[model samples]
Target: MQSYWNFPAAAGGTINSINNAGIETFKGNELDSLTREICQNSLDAIKDESKPVVVEFKSFKLQRNQFPQRAELLEAFNKCETTWKGKNPKSEQFIDQAKYILNEQEIPFLRISDFNTKGLEGAQTGELGSPWSSLVREAGSSNKGDSSGGSFGIGKSAPFANSKLRILFYSSQDLSDYQSHIGVANIMSFEKQPGQITLGTGYFTNNENSNAIPGLINLDPGFNREETGTDIFVSAFEPKDMNWVEAIRNSVIYNFFITIWQNKLVVKVDDEVISHENIGSFIAQLDDTNEDYRHVKNYFRLLTSEDSIQIPYPAKSYKKIGKFEEGEATLFIMKGEDLNRRVLMTRKAGMRLFEQNRISGSISFTGILIITGKHMNQVFKKMENPAHTLWEPSRFEEAPKEADTAFKDLRRFVRETVQQTFQAETTDTMDAFGLSDFLPDTTTVDGEGDDKKESLTLKIKSIAQKKKEKPKKKLKKKQRNEEFEDTLADAGIIPEGDQAGHSDEEREEGLGLGGGTGNTHGEQGPSDEGTGGAQEGKGEKEKNKPIDVEKRYVCLQKNEGLYRVNIKPEKKFEKGKLEFKVSGEQSDYILPILDVQSPDIQVISIDKNVVRFINLTGKKLKNIKVKVDYEQYCVMEVDLYEI
Candidate 1:
């Protein structure tokens, strides 16, 4: 069959945008997206239970004639060069690769093959919701089911971005048709120029066949005729990052470990093979210093029963349901190495939201919280943004109001769990609010015991005012007012001169500062004003002054020589930066060092025995950790609070 290169409608500037779209989907790490995207597609292609899915990545040198549709592909390459110069003004590699693919006898190519899977199969109608339609003919149309990992169908851009020639060949054996289909597409930025134009995204296929669409062929020498699978060949493949091969391997093993462990998939990179049997050894290649490695390793070990840790649902009482009864949470904690503090949270599918790290406080322990039940799935799913990185309830405010309530309950549950796990009895201030006193009957009443029966019941009552009769001794208006004033003067109802006629009861209720009356009862006291001052005297002038404005902190001695420092930001400073100095008084301790807990706060330096830092976080309050070091092998706790 005579082959011809068919190009799609070259919309003005549309190809430019599409060329950049795939690259933008994976901005930071190209290899991460590459591994994730290709692997996801392979998993979705799995249609056989008896045979395992095997994906292979291989590099080989192939002669130009070996390619089945070399003539049409060369035509496509020649056409790609017409506008390549204008598109990539400085990229000589583009011209070199294009010329090499067309003129050279031999070229290097990357072949990524997936075995024992249903290859891209569907009627080639250029229609939506078809694997063949989307993979070969469409750009962003998706045919993925709900359980599929990819949704946008833009993941193919990763491989295209990695290809030096911006051309990739798709060869797959449709199990139902029992026929192999070979196609090639070059997605790149192109300058629109008359009849020579093509939407950088087009197919290289048979031209003689009347039923043929763009970018399709019937055969290829590289196609595995004995097996049903797909092979994606990248002509002139080269990665910008030098260490991409190793990095991609590690990423693949780390990300697909769950699939590997279940014996569902196997990956081969060049000569080395990665499968469930040897997945652990492959994972060891990842940087051990990274918290990600530790998390994955520990998680895998936990699943395989290799680690010594026990995590159970929190005692039933710890799980609280809000008024909606929509969600409940349980915390599982363990004592392990003080690495990264993370709380692994999962939804109904058991896929954890990795970016959402709920752990607070120091990295002294590990915790895992499984918050699920009732309407939580609807709430969490609705809350998940496109990235699936967070459960931001605010993003879903337009959703049902119930979802907002459920989201709030989830947050409260997380906060309370974190406090219970980390802070312990440090919540005395919250307990001081006397909130429990307002709650309904918590304890059962005993009818037998008289004391238990005499529980307190608060009641609200209305009091009536009494009418007073006219005084027997009548006098003029001035005399009557004077008489009332004399009576009030004796009773100390009003202030007299600077002495401030405050009764003993009023004095007791005043500022409570030494002997002075704090504030009169049923009157506007200094405490009632917006400021900290009273309505009378100096208190009135100083009204609106904040209470507890002094800077105060509490230091808790953790170990014998270590202490945790907490600064009260709300009570002292609210805006701008704050500076504090900590000096060691002990003669034995020289050059005392303080280790900062949070990256948001910067620690300037430590000179001699003093440690200084400025609060970089503008938040109203923060808990800053200042670790005081003593002489080597010495046992003593430096008093930071006293200093």
Candidate 2:
């Protein structure tokens, strides 16, 4: 007998040729999309089980030629299963069939019970439909589920994108029967056409496959279990283009986990459990413990559908929730569906859902909803309709009357809550940082406080206003002058032009003087002829015989003081001569002759005992005597005074 097999004509071509011929296309944000998809699937699986779920990660590397591995296969299965989980049968049945086919190929898989996989059963035949039948059935009922974040059904192709490898997966779901379980094991191989991959299956055992594993193959001698749970094994997974640690951390931060009620969602990276911290708690702790973490908190709520609303519920009494070893206090209130949930060490309220008629329930820790980078852009695009008013109406007059009324009340309530919280926290922090002195201290009043509080606030405001309005006084000029003078005095100098003299007494003494005398002497007069006795005797003879004018002469008496003398003789007498004689009290007078013609004369030369006279001023004198030895003449003094 001869056997014949048919294959594609291009099957023998090189991987590069197959890749370039449109047989593979990998241009997608597949890694990011797949990570999210896988996380969602794990969450759903745990949610379905209604038990604690622990996802353990282990380090494994897939090389280029190692075409298939267990991790990659499990990742692919998760994507396909989650994509068709809640969809209608017609549209998603193909993917469902693919999963079933892959399960049938992975046979003789291991079952474990160490974690939560207790009470599980192995695969049983006659449970799932034929591979072809399941494919058709799944195709008829394909519709996307609510919890899936990715739009494209190609998320399953992500882990296989960059390599030629094969992956195997072993996973199980809890069965209703305590001793029975539904489980699957599968393999996926990457082809040259980038993200496009071929899937095959191994054995699965189940009491019945209720459209659970569409193309699953049944293994003989199914194993029985005492406890029930699922297990996943991933083999050849290509590392994502981006950093894996960052990708996993971000997915954990943003994706919804509110529906995880009974199960604890655990994620591990390379066999290490990633520590999950609530965003609010983390922020609060950072602020309280780290001085640098102090910053403003911006609160926002994002809602997708129009029917979603934020209803205001009445404020409840606050109660202290937790106390730190450092004496820091945390407070909270009992409200909303998650009222029993322990509020974190920080006092911020978590997200809460309120029912109609202002009743609250269903709280969520929405502090984790941080929109960043691409996610932020997506939100902006999605919220473009009516373009969030930021607490304002488009047209105030056109707003519905009922909505307006409710909005005003709600606004007041929200504002009050925010103000109160801000004040309380600010006070607490100021005390902690030793900055309380920088802020004003004011007593906070309760909701029922009176208008007097408003009055006190107004008074404080008035005081501040008055301070601002008061006028400043200008400096006086006199004071400035005095200050300048004082400075000059310190430097040691009298001011300009203040000298000592020019007093009143000096002027008064110089005003009293009059005027007085002048005197001159000396002239020669006629001499009397015939002296007394001779005259008497002669009188007898010729008593009156005329004395010859030229022959007889008598000396004239000299003036009492030193004098200048002048003499005149009668013109008719031909030899008349005038003689002047010096007399000493009627004794004989001796006359010494001196020069009568020279103008320059020395009256007496005392040492030689000589006397001479010279004419001065061109005047000639006939009878003048110069004496050299007379004591009175030699001692004479001449006095000339200002007349």
Candidate 3:
């Protein structure tokens, strides 16, 4: 029975030492990597699409005497200890620990079994790209298709990394009715004889064909995988390390929650079943205080919340990325507080790759982008790093230009969506440690148009405080004309021949959304304020000339009525203030005079608007930022005061 174990002696110059660089890729993320890889592989081999794939993570103990090839393994360990006495201290220390573990009366092991899958196919043939070979014998080999969750084969190392003994057993009952078992040890080279060195990698098999045993061997008396699918066993699983269980549970919930939510996968950690039926319960029980845990909680919330906006990724992106076939995918965004401001990108299979971080805007939002078509999945899968965390441009060595534009297009699409949908720059102060991101008596109001939803930057106001606004004192025609002339003079806009196309009726009511400078025909800047300033002194001819303001951005924060405006000036100005106004189907009007705050721009006087802010800062008045406060409303518009 023990004759099948094989560890051949290497030639004189060749020596097999322990090289765990593959496993080391998952060093700090052992359990997560393991959980993610196992479920992904299982999902890839779904035999029945109607049934959910079930996986069990359980622990069992076996006596040392029942361990197969105990004597042969002990001899190898003893030889390794003697041969590498002082050469490799780490290896020497590891071998000492492994030897001690082997001598214990009962050893603990973890068996991960998956059911309702085709299992490892082509087990009868040890081909280079066979599932069994790719998983057990070969390194960095995969025959999975585009729809599959992963292609880079380094994921198999995760399970081995989890083993303190650096040993694992692979047993599978393939759908073809073939059952086989194999034991692989990743250890250091050992001196088999006085002058002979055996290879570091050893196999436990019986015959000349050392790939696999005929049938599954009994690992534990009560624990066995009688169903179809694969079972991976890790020796010296560190049963005393309860942290491992927690790590496994967290990983399952974080990475596979979508899979479970879709009824495509189910995970069991020592009888604690995490399935589609209980995903909400599991998420509700999680303490979102843990930043790491909060991500999945929020993601799950976005998945189920009807408030989430489903925006499809552009079909043009497929063509821009040099792909012929179009793929369908959606980015679901939930705009609110308690968000990480990142987008989670997942394969169509429902297993997430990673949260795409540093999304361009400061919107109080988090999202999930599900890549759901075969061709598109293939495109992104190729661009993914070995870890599948980000979409890197360097991956497209053939066409670097397309790679360059792909990211720009993605970001532009997201920006355009936000502008078209939210119609405002959104941001919020994340809860300062211990403080809740929630408020009592939250309120929401209807947006401007049929399509517009609640504004992300809109502040909450109670019904009691939301009484009708006090009407603005109607200004006389002369006063309105004079005010209009002053605003035009400051904006450097001398309207066409006196009043362009305005009548006494229009002039008497208010500015009446006057057309001039850059802000005519309703072009809101999406951020800072509506266009037209001292900068636009001339028409298209002045396009190349410098302006008083180069660029600016406006952000509406959580604080009631607070707005932060960032301004970059093209030229120096001793002072400038941003005036506020409102215009719509109704005649244009001014906001009720309120408080103003700024580091650079001070309240010289608040008639309608006055900042002529800060000496305009920066020696040359290069750029200045200001935060102002007033009654909050989405219709508010701004204008840079007298230059």
lDDT (CA) per prediction:
0.51, 0.28, 0.66
- Runs in model 3 lying further than 4 Å from the true structure: 1-3, 12-16, 239-241, 317-321, 324-327, 336-340, 357-363, 424-643
TM-scores for the candidates: 0.58, 0.28, 0.67
Compose the digit string of candidate 3's lDDT tens values, residues 1-643.
Answer: 5544577766775675566778789887677888888888899888899999998888888799877778778888888888889898888888889899889998888899899988777667776788888887777888888888778788888888888888888888988779988888878788878788876778888765567877886786777677789888888887334777777887888888888999999999986999999999988887767765788888988889888999877676444565533436777887877566667778787877766543323355778888787766777677778876666766866655676566556555554565456545333333356443443223433433555344336676755656797764421222222233334334443332223343322322223322211221122221223322223333332112223332222323424544333333434555444555555655555544355555555545454333334453642222223333444333444555333
lDDT of 1 by residue, 273-387 (tens): 8898998877666677876787767555544653334333332211232232323444444434543344555543333455223234332344545445434444455566544
Q: Cα RMSD to native, each candidate?
A: 18.9, 53.8, 15.5
lDDT tens digits, residues 292-385, model 2?
Answer: 1221111111121232223323432212211112111112222222121111111111111111111101122111111122322222222211
**Candidate 2 local Cα displacement, residue 313, angstroms:** 7.7
Go through the candidates in order and give the clash count of each.
14, 64, 10
Highest lDDT, which number? Answer: 3
Error of 1 at 290 (Å): 3.8
